[model samples]
Target: MPPYPTGSWMPVALSADLPAGTVMPAQSPAGPVALWRTRSGRAAAFADRCPHRGMRLSHGFVRGETLACIYHGWSYAEAGNCQRIPAHPALTPPDTIRVATQHVEDGGGIIWISVGEPAAGPPRFEGLAPLRSMVAEAGIAALEAAAGTKAAGGLLDYTHDDRAVQLLLAPDGQARTLMHVLVDEDSNPDERIAASRAAEALRRAAEDIARAGIAR
Candidate 1:
């Protein structure tokens, strides 16, 4: 079986973690990506590299609707077009000076980035609230061993201490996983806390399995 689902909209981050007018580092099947939301609360994803001097745009800061490179202050609009060059304030940047962008969807409290030209929108899990996200230093096989079952559609159903939750996972490179925890929408505060703790324990268990060189 495949490690996890691929070639569709991938859950990259929780919407709550990314406030408006902020930029964050993310991943894509193509390469590293820069995910950001504008001051108007529009989300956009771009190839992380700056077209001007090869700087990582994730390190850049958001200014209004544009994300500006931290190195030379080259500003790119939400459409990935270079709008301003600080060094040449009077010159308008050419349209060719643009950063590559990808399709983004923010729904069901998650930020989903399309892997390619997907034909459909992201899948939604009704009545699920995102709890938290963390990286596990383990591959999918190790995680499957820890959870006692394999993932389906990039989701794994896990329960601990009679508390059940869903884990949305995406491969972070070769041997790491980006996991997002989700609890029932109506779950109370105490239950949310418990779910978070259970997810942490699962992460530790998976890591241990990976370190022991155990393959599922």
Candidate 2:
């Protein structure tokens, strides 16, 4: 993760978490978003609630390139236009029947959703590969205390056993964070495991710091 202007890109998910032809709910500054990927592996984000009956679009199913509302079976194209209405198959759904879409970008094993119109793209963690993501039950300050260092530009570099792990942070509402763990792509399995434990330890430390409100 890299810091950007208030209205900018937010790395909400990893590419592996959102497989093609699946949808998941994610949070953004604007609110919750229905993040989905087509069978062709193209990712898109839309307002989580369906305009038809207020059902969550994330609970809907994806067929081909369209997302169908689970409640009413209304199908929406990738562009968010209503393409089919099961109730009135012969009738054309009005153009007004559409879900709001957000700009999405996928690269470096991360999915970046726009908070607004970002004048830039997501950061590229060169030579590093995303390992896993975990939610920290604390704020950035707590995380800093846990790691014994403050993150710069939303990335905290933790070096242990001569191996460095990079953390990409995304704030979720308040008193919580989403951290994407990244390590060198060619790291050995043992090293990857160590990195994972290191992250867990850091999380514990951060949570403790938060609970105690004491700097360590």
Candidate 3:
């Protein structure tokens, strides 16, 4: 978890979390993103700010294949080019009006956004299934200290009691981290619930350790 370089894939969200015709705000190493899916079910990420009046584009609406800003109703295509200006429907919007775009990939139950051109694709969890995602108030160092190990290629092996849970961490800003909980694909319902609670406990401990400056 927490790949630091700019030219790599960052797992930003879960595919199930972003439904068709909806937009949500996500963060990347570059900046904030307006992650959205078109009515036709194609996903794309754009700069979160609207070009018209500096409004957050994540507050926009999705119609067909375009995302429209809620403030001025300026719609943009998936490629980040402005497609329509409601105020001047007769005039085609110029190419100059556009938002920044990032390459997005969805697989292994996670949504990945690329800040720069990645040489390869995101890591695939071959034998695990994503349970849920949570925001931890601690950094990666703290999480590693709490888990008693460092992550390997985005997979953090954490042991609770005798059970093992794989945690995938994604960084947000500086002091926070996004934790994606992964369980064995064959885990039972009880095991899954227990794993969730254990992850929460780990988060609390990591946060405490980070606050106390004990994470090294």
- C-alpha lDDT values of all predictions: 0.89, 0.86, 0.88
The regions of model 2 sitting more than 4 angstroms off are 1-4, 160-163, 214-216
| Clash totals, every prediction | 0, 0, 1
Off by over 4 Å in 3: 214-216
Worst 10 residues of 1 by lDDT: 1-10
Tens-digit lDDT string for candidate 1 (1-216): 333245578888999988999999997776799999999998999999999899999999999999999999999998899999999999999999999998899998999988767778899999898889999999877788899887888899988778787899988887888999999999999998999999998999999999889454
lDDT of 3 by residue, 2-47 (tens): 5546667788888888999999999987789999999998899999
Q: After superposition, how far is residue 197 of candidate 3 from its true place, in Å?
A: 1.0
Relative to the true structure, candidate 1 reaches a TM of 0.95
Alpha-carbon RMSD to native, per candidate: 1.9, 2.5, 1.9
What are the clashing pairs of model 2? none
Decreasing lDDT order of the candidates: 1, 3, 2
Q: TM per model?
A: 0.95, 0.92, 0.95
- Candidate 2 on 120-202: residue-level lDDT in tens? 88778888999999999998777877777778877888765566678888887678888889988999999899999888888
Best-to-worst ranking by TM-score: 1, 3, 2
